[model samples]
Target chain A: MSQFVMPSLGADMEDGTLVEQLVAPGDPVQRGDVIAAVETQKGAIEIEAFEDGFLDRWLVPLGAKVPVGTPLAMIRTGDPPATPDIPQPKDPAVPPPPPETPQPAEPDLPPAVPEDPPLAPEPPAPPPEKMGTSHRQRVTPAARRRAAQTGFDLSALGGDRVISLDDVPSAPTADAPKPLSAMRQAIAAAMARSKREIPHYYLSDTIDLTAAEAFIASRNADLPPDARLLIAVLFIRATARAAQSFPEFNGYFEEEHFSPSAAAHVGMAINLRGGGLVAPALLDANEGNLETLMMRLRDLVMRVRKGRFKARELAEPTITVTSLGDRGVAGITGVIFPPQVAIVGIGTPGWQPMVIDGQLVARRVANITLAADHRVSDGHRGARFLRSIIDHLQQPEAL
Target chain B: MNDKDIRALMIRQLGQIAPDVPFDTVDPDADLRDEFDIDSMDFLTLITALGKELGLSMPETDYDQMRSFVGLQRYLSSHVT
Candidate 1:
């Protein structure tokens, strides 16, 4: 049997009313099928089944309020719970999603739960090793089979602990991506501060990327895999070089004063492998040539993803660049990260009809947007800075 | 290597990028991005890994040709000795 819980959609949500049940008992439901709708603080959110099963029974009736994780219904999966018998597609060019449970481990501090300690004597309990050899002997052959069937590594139970049938974990669900609660809070705080403090002005331009695309293709043709540049490298390079001439958009704002840095330390936003976003600085972003810049970007991306980013690299960004070209978004208007006066957003590049020298032809184009602190620089300055970035992208050989 | 060996190696390398995906059920002709929702970085990372494994280079210009499982295997078969 499996559970369909009352899922908490927001951080502050405590409980929700089951306004309606979309599926009745005995209904065969597929994964991702919306089975119920709950009324929370954020209005009605339709909850979906996480596993393929039939609804066996409803634990909570309609109009009942329940807290998050309170199972609303029981589901009959009708088979031995799926173990990690993952079939790797023999000829797959497309890989299967990683067979990993996305849920974070419980916030358990330690295994030091005190079990009826006598305060007067304070004598430590008998060590597991001293009383312990019996614990190993008590392991049933059937329990070992249960552990193996569930793909729970038996060695994980450890030599110190007693093994029991109850200790075997059920099949892990890799269906959902982990919710990054801690990272989400940190992002919320920063963005909230940005909105509260910075008076922002936004500017956008549709720039043709034919020249840049051709340049990257030509350059990457002969380079090794490690040395090759992704299109993001160009976005970073262009933003950094453009910030060189426009000092207003390229510096820190602190203590009611705007101090423009001589060098542009562009913060390139990278989405991590599992989930979450990090924008670490590429030190001396404007000074390096494209080859050197690509090398730095590669190193920074690799290091940040591995959670090995240096303190200085994480903190030294003067301006930020977020490129969403690959995800297929047209444009994004970013809120300026506090203390940084400007952020550049690069949207997806698409083939658009453009007239070049009186001939209408298809060319690669992207929407570049500038969101700057209006307290330091107005729309005129922001527009000019965006224009300069577009100009730099025009001549990739020069940039 | 035989086709079986090549497929096994490809799945293993892809496993590194998408640690939670079920690779065995993916259609060989499906796009990795569409199948597993891998972004550009993951795609590039996969290419880098494939290059390292096969001792070859796949230029950005040729990424589209290697978009599917069958396509990647073909690319490796032709490029690898």
Candidate 2:
């Protein structure tokens, strides 16, 4: 017997609601097949099976929000499907009563802390003037600040329970979409945890993309518009190769130990149409050529926009790359995602005057930044990694 | 087809790719990207849909010629059978 559990998609995710189940009991499933769709604060993600087996049963029901590592289903590996203990009634008129077996002692275990004393005082409730009727309403600190900042009536939330950050609107502008405060809090908490635990070092470089632009333009000249390549694919391909060479930056640092990943699964930060951003991995990125990476990147972007993602794409990113798409920002300094030691960021590529062999010439340049865990790699090695990416970008056809 | 019929078809096809685009307020002469903030993917989808709808083949180099509403119409008119 094997257990299929709810995978923690990212450092910030705690629980995910199972939106759907794509597999049924007794169905044979292969590894990498999408078996379920789990919805997190980020979006709806299609969860994949990690092993080949016959699904025995679903332990979690649809739309149930389960914590990370909570068993979602059971699979039978080597044995035949077990016959259910309780036999179904032959007559449709009479339904059989549920079995009266005693429950396990795990639920009866003592709580982590006694209920006698609280850890800290609850935050001061919102004032009556700020909130219409629910004066002493429970609200998160971030939500409280946002309410105060926007002057939004807390009573308008229409909930008697705790008002979370999701209740607060970033702005009252009619056209602006409601901010995804849950994703924001998740990001904040993870960033805080990363800052507290990982010693992060930052490196930035401006690379000339003249050769890459020409290469892409020629490459796409014959192809249709939908098949054209973007600079992002090049960046991801180069980063994957650089990570292959620099193994130190390509894995998890857990329990005060660094374990490098065998394959380079590069995560690309894709911004959703509605709001928040998600970094889903391109599996075995180092193995693919530019054409493969471009096709995969296109598919990944479309899936992300439509709220469809495989579990492996979410859970197995060894390193992350975030590009501010067409925003024209010169550079960006990124915060490290926890457990993973490194994150690479690429800013917009724009035309700039450059000195080529002492003669001034115009060139398109993009700034690349890397944030690495200091505990796993030093500034010297980090610089080399950045340099490797730069060299790869210059020879665009080779990528 | 006349210009009016071609314009209507173009709008319908563009809407298929970008449903949120405010066709009522869109300027035919202005750049679609500048006016609507359409990214590369959306632009590609719109171009592909137009090509398929009109039975025209548009190479990558001619993408700039199809940037605006009127530009796409002109390109399709010239290239279409």
Candidate 3:
């Protein structure tokens, strides 16, 4: 039996609580099938099974917080030599709607206490509190989980030793519309780390999209509505193609070394309905056509909102693109997510007067900006990379 | 489809794109993008959904014309058979 340990969702995640188990003992599972939902600081992440086999059993009980790399379940591969069979859970009949009695902290204290405090015992060990009192700031696991979900710093509650349910504040007293959710906290931490470590240089240029728009219009005229392409798809395709041309911006920078990736996985930044944002990769972006890319983007957006994402999507984005086109922003400069060398930002397209063939004509134009790690590339290289995107966009038939 | 039926269908199609939009508060002539939080994606979804429901094909050239409630109704009435 092969052990399925908790897969780290992102660099920011330390530990996560197994919220729900989707598979039962003896159930067959494929490699990519989602087997469990883990609640981390990032939110409810659906954990996919990495190995194909019969799910032997859950190793960790639900609601128990465990650090990263902890074994979550056992997948019976039955491939190698005689393996020891793990006994099935005692009550295997009941599945995971209600977590089978959270393993209570097995205390060292003596059991079998009288209904009333035994006579002659000096104030009889004060009715052993259900919540642990040994720790100076004792907060119940359930309470801590709730606080994390609500983004309230429990440490804010001054030196109170034993914390009860009532001690946790429900909301933050600030002007913000809503208190930062766990996802927002995670995003902030990641961005802060990105900005602190990566020395970034930004370049912006307004690209005329008149020819590209016309090309898209003609191309989309014959297709069905669902199959029709969006300008954003063109944006991604062009960027992917440009990255293929200018290889400097399309890879990870690690250990004071720049590794250029052969395959371009463009991370598309999707804003969540509830506050934060996640930029999951559009795998093999350079190879796909506009139609396939659009469909994949649609599916990715849908799955992301539903909290269903594969592990690779989160971890494998070599470069990211953040489009503020929907919101009427003019231009944006992104802070490169650490390890990833560059980030591309696209602004809203608007009609602007341009001189075409010595005549002023209204053309659809958008500001495309590139933020690259200065350690890997200079402004000249960044400008050339941006020019490549413009060149591809200008010739949309190639995209 | 009749004008009233088409309008009703259009509202339903729009609801699929953005369910939280208060239909009663929606101004037919105002740009939905500005009034509500309907982005380009939602706008495209709305157009696609309408096309699917009505068995019509909406070209990318006509997106701006069909962006608002009034614009969509006018465009559908004129372009659709």
Every candidate's chain B TM-score: 0.88, 0.82, 0.86
Give a tens-digit lDDT track for model 3, residues A184-254. 56676678878888899989999998888888788788998788777888888887888888788998887
Question: What DockQ, between 0 and 1, does each candidate earn?
Answer: 0.31, 0.49, 0.52
lDDT tens string, model 2, A110-183?
22233332322343354435546544557787787656655667778765789988878854422223333565
Candidate 2 lDDT score at position A39: 76
Candidate with more favorable, higher DockQ: 1 or 3:
3
Best by DockQ: 3
1 or 3, which is superior by TM-score?
3
DockQ of 3: 0.52
lDDT of 1 by residue, A152-226 (tens): 556666656557788766442222223335445445556777889999888999989999989888888998777
* Candidate 1 lDDT: 0.73
* Model 2 chain A weakest lDDT span, ten residues long: A102-111
Off by over 4 Å in 2: A79-180, B1-6, B9-18, B25-28
Evaluation by DockQ, superior candidate among 2 and 3: 3
What TM-score does model 2 score on chain A? Answer: 0.75
Task: Give, for candidate 3 chain A, the lowest lDDT window spanning 10 residues.
Answer: A103-112
DockQ of 1: 0.31
Clash pairs, candidate 3, are: none
